[model samples]
Target: MALDIIAALVYGIITIIGGIIGYINASSNISLVSASICGLLLIFAAFARLQGQTWGLTLAAIVTAVLLVVFAFRLAKTRKFMPAGLMTILGMLTLAVMIHQFMALRR
Candidate 1:
């Protein structure tokens, strides 16, 4: 659980940084806004998990799943490994940890 929470926070920070970088490089307001919201939500989820709330990890898992798919699509389209591919891989690991933690919490 602690590990998951930490992973969630790290992932969130990475996402937020990615968004800022994306905006800086491409000037995409959409990317900045969306990523900021998503990253904040993940950070909030980590806090909730720290409070022993199962929904927190569940939220993290859902968000990670969504982002994983989106990044996967971006990777497929761009064939790039720096942002999209990297994020996709990170999201997979984060989601897996979140799911495992949630299941253990439920049991």
Candidate 2:
């Protein structure tokens, strides 16, 4: 749980940083728009997680899973454990949330 929280914070910070850099260096409107949206989403998600809401956790887990799947494959050649571990945990959390949500819906 602590690792997940730290990872979420790091991811949010990096997203905001990248968005600012893109806004400053990007020449096209589309690029700026996309970066801004991404940055805002990251910030919002971070705050939501901090609030300890289930929805926030779900969103964070989903994002983490996608990131892990995309980057883990490239990093797998280096035999790194961080990405793989994060992915596995995130996937489990997401699955748990989905199941809970489904059960609630059925009720």
Candidate 3:
């Protein structure tokens, strides 16, 4: 549980930072808006996890799953491991942490 909360918080922070960078580098409002939404969702998910809400974990898991798929696809298509690969790795770790916490809760 502790690990899950910590990982979620870290992931949220990283996501927010990435969003800000994306916003700065984005060529259009659409990308900026999308990044903003993603960052906000991640922030809320982190707070929810900290509050011990099941929904928070669920939200984080869902978001991470989506990110994992996207990043994995990008990595495969580009054959690069810098950002996409790295983010995918982190997403996977976060997912694992969430699963561990959920299983412990079930027991």
Candidate 4:
């Protein structure tokens, strides 16, 4: 699979798992629902990207960016290096990879 696909998949899986964890640990339905939606969007984007669709990368970038910002805020508010911090870091890396892949796609 392409690096873009891999990155998206990894990020999606991680997000989904985090949601599941949140649901299990704290019964946060919002977290589970939001993460599931975001993760599924990423997964769908991966398939679209596999078919050479620009919108796929665009969607992936947007979703990742949103998640990154949310996590960053959560991290800042909590000042704890745990779920929020970890997610923020992952989101940053995933978004970076998606951006690089998008540039390559343009070229």
Best by TM-score: 1
Q: How far is candidate 3 from the true structure (C-alpha RMSD, Å)?
A: 2.0
Q: List clashing residue pairs in candidate 2.
A: none
| Local accuracy of candidate 1 as per-residue lDDT tens digits, 3-102 | 8999899999999999999999999998899899999999999999899887888888888899999999999999999899999999999988887887
Root-mean-square deviation of every model: 1.0, 7.3, 2.0, 0.9
* Residue 8 Cα positional deviation in candidate 2, in Å, after optimal superposition: 2.0
| Runs with alpha carbons beyond 4 Å of true place in candidate 1 | none
Tell me the TM-score of each prediction against the true structure: 0.95, 0.47, 0.83, 0.95
Instruction: Give the per-residue lDDT digits (tens) of candidate 3, residues 1-107.
Output: 47877787777677666656656776556545654666567668878877878788788788778878987998999988856788889999999998998898899
- Residue 37 of model 1, lDDT score: 92
Off by over 4 Å in 2: 64-107
Native-referenced Cα lDDT, model 4? 0.90
Tens digits of per-residue lDDT for model 4 on 1-107? 78888888889989999999999999999999999999999999988988978798889889999999999999999998879999999898898898888788779
Model 3 misplaced stretches (Cα beyond 4 Å): 25-31
Q: What tens digits encode model 2's per-residue C-alpha lDDT throughout 3-44?
A: 444555566565455446646676556545644554455456
Model 3 — TM-score against the truth? 0.83
- Stretches off by above 4 angstroms in model 4 are none
Estimate the TM-score for candidate 4. 0.95
Give the higher-lDDT candidate: 1 or 4.
1
